[model samples]
Target: MAKGDILKAALSNPNRGPHQTALIRSAIYKEMEQFTATRRLPPSLDASEICRILAPIDRHLTPDDYDRLHKFSDFLAVIDTSPNAHPGYHLLGEKLSADLGL
Candidate 1:
């Protein structure tokens, strides 16, 4: 499946609750780790696609999910620091912040 599709599928059940959410997050983290293994960053378009797909589930993410994303993706680190770097970054950052009250 495509990256965005994978995320969408994982997040399809919005009311699945926290345990399922955590499992989904772990799967996403593992996929991201594999995807980023040889690259320092995802292309901007790819990141945007992923962020957009993840927007709906941003509220479902645990703090540990955010931590794992930060640890794995330099792309996310850059996005977190400079949200204006791309529309995707801004959208994702805003969603995360609003969802988590961070």
Candidate 2:
């Protein structure tokens, strides 16, 4: 995604607070793409670095908003590695999905 690109959520609806689903200045979508392309999981992805990258994305993204993303599952895991991201979004998924670097 472009640097100024905005990943908005519930665009047609305004019931949610503006900041809850804001337009963050980031290239995270692209970063996540590369991260996923590596086909790595957990430690391989460098949890600390992942969390650092996710800080901005998570601030503007609410839990419910993420459910709509096409890459929510994996993205959720990566972003949740950050202590700053929203909680309860991090789920320990299947152990043998073949994407765990096993």
Candidate 3:
């Protein structure tokens, strides 16, 4: 899952109005910037920050849309931690799998 995929989902999400889309877009870019600088995903990669950013627009999103956003969160978690980018390099896969319950 490329970062663009998440952004595209937000851009085309029919359940949200322009304001909600704009806010999510902003939040995504912010997190993206953080990743570019640190190569580290946010805590848990659950998109918690995105959800927090959405708090103001929570009532505006349909339940499914909200869930979709979280699915993006879960997707991020999977993408970042899967395939063991450096398998066995440092027992990293074992540790991540245990940490993420994968």
Candidate 4:
């Protein structure tokens, strides 16, 4: 999916289901053991780094929603690995949260 589409969908839907929200929340809160993976200043981590399954969201999420989440995952992957995350990270995150109602 195109990056823009995913971001748009994320903005469209911020309300998330309980199960999906829980899964995301866990990712948001969980600590990683590979803190040194960055080999530099401590960096943040994403859901994919911790592990992920869209099954919880696939139940009712739209393709756009999936795309949005996928994009968010990609964003997390970057920020989690490096300190210089995309400027849109927070925007995309807000969109995803709103879209999933997180």
Candidate with top TM-score is 1
- Measured on C-alpha atoms, candidate 3 has an lDDT of 0.48
Backbone clashes in model 3, listed as residue pairs? none
- Count of backbone collisions in candidate 3: 0
The per-candidate count of clashes, in order, stands at 0, 0, 0, 13
- Each prediction's TM-score versus the true structure: 0.34, 0.21, 0.33, 0.32
List the candidate 2 regions with Cα displacement exceeding 4 Å. Answer: 1-6, 9-41, 44-96, 99-102
Put the candidates in TM-score order, highest first.
1, 3, 4, 2
Local distance difference test values of all predictions, in order:
0.46, 0.36, 0.48, 0.43
Q: What's model 2's overall lDDT?
A: 0.36
Q: Which ten-residue region of model 4 has the weakest summed lDDT?
A: 33-42
Tens-digit per-residue lDDT, 24-85, candidate 4? 53543332222223432213334342223332433555566455456544554555555765
Per-residue lDDT tens digits of candidate 1, residues 49-93?
444344235576655544434332334334334544332454456
Let me know the TM-score candidate 1 reaches against the reference structure.
0.34
Which prediction has more favorable lDDT, 2 or 3? 3
In angstroms, what RMSD does candidate 4 have relative to the true structure? 10.5
- Kindly list the per-residue Cα lDDT of model 2 for residues 1-102, writing each as its tens digit: 321122333233355554433322233344444443243344434433333333334456455445433243334345525444322223223222334655
Off by over 4 Å in 4: 1-17, 31-60, 80-102
When sorted by lDDT, best at the front, the candidate numbers are 3, 1, 4, 2
**Residue 43, candidate 3: how far off, in angstroms?**
25
lDDT of 3 by residue, 1-102 (tens): 554365545645565575765666565665455343134333443344444433334456666555555554444444555543221212333345657878
